[model samples]
Target: MTPATIPSRFGLACVLGSALLLSACAEKQVILPGERESVRPEADLSESRIRLDGNTARAIQLPAQRVNAEWTQGIGSPAFRVDHAALGGQLQHLWEVPIGNPDSRRARITASPVVGGGLVYTLDSGAQVSAVTPEGAVAWSTNLTPASERAIDSTGGGLAYANGTVYISSGFGLLSALDARTGELRWRQKLEANGSGMPLVRDGVVYVVAGDHTGWAVDAGNGRVLWQIMGAPSVTTVLGSGAPATSSDLVVFGFGSGDLVAAFRQGGMRHWAEAVAGNRLGRAVSRISDVTGAPVIAGDRIFAGSHSGRLAAFDLHGGEELWLARQGALGPVWPAGDSVFAVTDLNQLARFDASNGSPIWAADLPGFVNDKPRKRGETWAHYGPILAGGRIITASNDGLLRFFSPESGQLVGQVEVPGGATTEPVVANRTLYVVSSDGKLHAYR
Candidate 1:
């Protein structure tokens, strides 16, 4: 029994007999009854690093679906939060009409179709705004590209409809107001930099952000600049814009540098500024730090997310950070009843507790080309987790509109979108409208 005198098991076995040597020295495999040998399951290379928090997974509850009359702003409303919207029944494609130029490398369709004035409005890649009637006929189309700027260069900006006018922001540094009925130009104001983001029209004021990191509050009626404030500059940023979110007293703006600034609604006085910047290690895209999704103001709290792996909730009064989650949102965060839904950077639809930022669940989305590994080809992008008709709906560049259950992360239904959706889908008057990458507006009932 002495430590040195006790030979190892392998040495003892080898010396016992040559016949037993091979069996004792080799590794063993234990097979259970009714089991057969098979290869190990392949690792899901496209899986997201975030996981469900079991404590709050079953605590999520959504509000009852209600019919929304109109979707006036690109973010659904000025506050950037829409509760469960009623969609009546399964989406049956009704009609589709060409909006304007399709998406291109130099120019992209960044604006989500807005619904108001009994018509659907869309901004195309070449700074063209088109209004389509509910019956799929083109009501009016107006080209907003200035004479000095090339059509391809005027790629960004968005659309908003309010009262009797359609508000437009163009990448060529212009803000215009046009008659909703006739598409006649009411007034156009020139800005110092390219207009980046949708114009938020609330109570006769238009709030927007520019590519130079400046926030503008303009007169909605005449396109007059009421107030302006500059945000921290960004050297590199995402391609599209982040619309401004507004409450009763303060309007919040998300900049390309991931700086979130709150200003007084009346005078544009800076209340406070916070940066939603936290890069995930080894993710090169996380370093961009752009607040691509518009900040959402729900009740007394404000929620926002950036491409740099930061989803945060702040107090509306003092800009205090209430909760922070390290998941970069690919689009606007949808805040429902007790949970907030977002399309994360990993192309997964995720639900998080609105109170504490704890993750509820995450459902994997199409990540790579044809759902293959990344090395195979290009990746696909997903947009929208809009709560409609009691289902969480998301449109993908892979040409599918996936509907998932809110209670669980299971995909309940899916529809093939022709040409693929380039922007988030909008719901209004029990109808769903989505703009395709091929410059077409598709409506479903």
Candidate 2:
């Protein structure tokens, strides 16, 4: 991949205003994933469809298997990648549980529900955290902040599961660890930077990208501050970027400015960082280069997509560009077998060649309000195209969960969720969980 001189818009630096002067910023220099040459076509704003190259126009075989038993983090796992998992006989709705207080709409659900330890964990719109049975029995529900702290103002943050613990990052600027089974608070730490999305836990560390366009590494066990990394802030961002993906020794994630960064998982030591936003076209939010998609780590390569920017692969170790394409996506792209599936900015669900970043197939989905989702604004859909069984399952705001063939992108099955899923759906123990913004948890078996 050829190196670009620009930076990513994922980090929210625009709102930084004068705060940019209060802190240090990384120099804007893009380092590619590998030594390979750039083979990507220029981004075309005119189409929601992907033009296939000769190799991509033909048939491609994708892996039909998935990881059984867990959707540990917001993006499946800390690596942000999972194989195809098996599903059951039917997509029947088993049960539903209210997520947060029903009376108030001020707090919107922002985090995907994660399942672990046979219990589904959710952080609701009202800054309330709950753990329940896969069958929808409420084991416990608790507020994350003080009574005075829970307000209609801010709604960000999510939950992550690892090592029998649940890590919570809140728009209230609080990070806390709770016992997975008991809902007991282990520790909580306040931050100068507010948490934006789901906090990822790997190798005893919890990684967070705050609203301030900064990255943090918190000790998962004790909630200690290990180290922090700062990136150029954008006046605006694409919903606080995606959850960071980790592998080898690097923790990589995108920022509001569309920057893809690689840092040591431990000490925040820099490996190589670059801008994922390929070109700066317009000043409109349409020009925002935020990489809202989480990075997918497979072997030595990391796959990522940006909103109104490029979809590219980079070398995990040395930060070299492998290949790129013009496709803007907000949710984390799913990589399985040999194909990577993405729900793009144009409302099209497409698959790309994992090895060379080639376009394999493109299919459209019903457009959701996510078309205009942003931080400090109204909530949007958490489109889930999770690969399971031999199909891809995705949820929308219309109380629907649709399934499609992984091979042909053909419609296979569909189901209606209660109140619809505002965030992405998560699966564990052969059960799929969708949490609606209305604080309702719908479980399908």
Candidate 3:
């Protein structure tokens, strides 16, 4: 990607403010074979129409398969089949694991656990990285020292499991490649300190964001630093967020404060760097959680939101600007099928046209009316939204997790996750894993 010298102000506002910073502000175990299965999938499993309300937990029935919808202004009638009603309240509890200290919310498990191949990997507030089985058994755990004191932000970019190896980044600037089955360290490399963004593994390359406001592509096999360049940081949390999106051979990411960029995965090279905003708030908050939105890699385009409330679609191959939309709050974009769900700072969820940057449907989540959301300085839809089992699961700053119809953007069902859900909901094996700020791990199926 070729770096653009003349940064577009409109693009900056849309990408950085809306897509990266604003939206960016912002998981659990499996069950055992026996031993009182914590949660089970809903039982009244039958074809039903979805009821969009708080009291009712219904599901929508559509086609068995859903195709991407063409770009439209409003959420049209479902062209596919949905089973939203299957997402009922007959939730069962699954296994629960405590990965952090009860007193220090700082070392919390803000990073959503990545469940794959029967194992879940997560980072705790103590800067401890752990791998566990579905039954709450810790396979291995490692303590990491952050480069700085505030490194353990509200979240920690998590580990990437691939090809029998686990890749993780510590806040103290260490990236390690470990054996996935044993969690044994294979290789380690040092980057800037306090760097803790999740790594994206494509082919054999691992890409991660550094707290120093740079992006690096490392060799997953040997932990060699392939390339490092200054790019968007993607979010404002202490552990940092945002997973770089890849299109063909290009890797796309946003800087902590400046712009969205695209680089080549094979060679530590630049494809395009488009500056989307200026550092108006200085480096404090910027370093805390700058560009927090992930670059959602769609077909031929790259979709990304920013902390500044700006959203942009860039050409994946050329890194050229395609379109930009402004939504005045920071949040991240969650894509369901073809539609991208963008959340605002105040806890509002907006659906946008995935192909082209345009508004489709929107709804304001309740909790913000009391002004406590702002007074507490919590961004709505702060954590990334989850699109699974025909439902969009998202939580607000005031601590409510709700499921919505992916096609209609209507609020379907909500449950109070007592301590406030600051982490993204993890859906695996038909169960919902939720981590609350109150030091509780919840499961719903």
Estimate, for each residue in 1-445, the C-alpha lDDT of model 2 and write its tens digit. Answer: 3344233332355547546664556566798796775465464433333432222344545666655677788562435344666677577888888867532445567788887787888877657889988667889877777567645655767788898999988878888898999999899987676675678888899988887778889988899899988877886675434688888678886777778888988689988997776642531444766777777787778878777657888888998999887776668788776787888766667888788876777766765444454533333354867877667888888778888777767767889877777778776667778877577888888
Q: What is the overall TM-score of model 2 with all chains considered together?
A: 0.81
Better of 2 and 3 by TM-score: 2
lDDT of each: 0.83, 0.74, 0.59
Candidate 1 lDDT, 1-445, residue by residue in tens:
7777667866777677776777788887986788665474343332343433332236456787778877888552444345777896577999999988999888888888888889889889888999999889999999987777678878877888889899988888888999999999999988788775778889999988888888999998777789999999997666567678888888898889998999999899999998887887656777888886678878888888888778899898899999889888888888887888899876779888899998888888876686545464577878887889888899988898999877777789998789999989889888899999999999888
Question: Is candidate 1 or 3 superior in TM-score?
Answer: 1
lDDT, candidate 3, 19-137, per-residue tens: 65645564235666856543744533211211112222223333343322111100111211121213434455555666653325445454555665566666665456677666667
What is candidate 2's CA lDDT for residue 241? Answer: 45
Better of 2 and 3 by lDDT: 2
Cα deviation of 182 in candidate 2 (Å)? 2.0
Report the Cα lDDT for candidate 1.
Answer: 0.83
What TM-score goes with each of the models?
Answer: 0.86, 0.81, 0.71
Query: Which is the better candidate, 1 or 2, if ranked by TM-score?
Result: 1
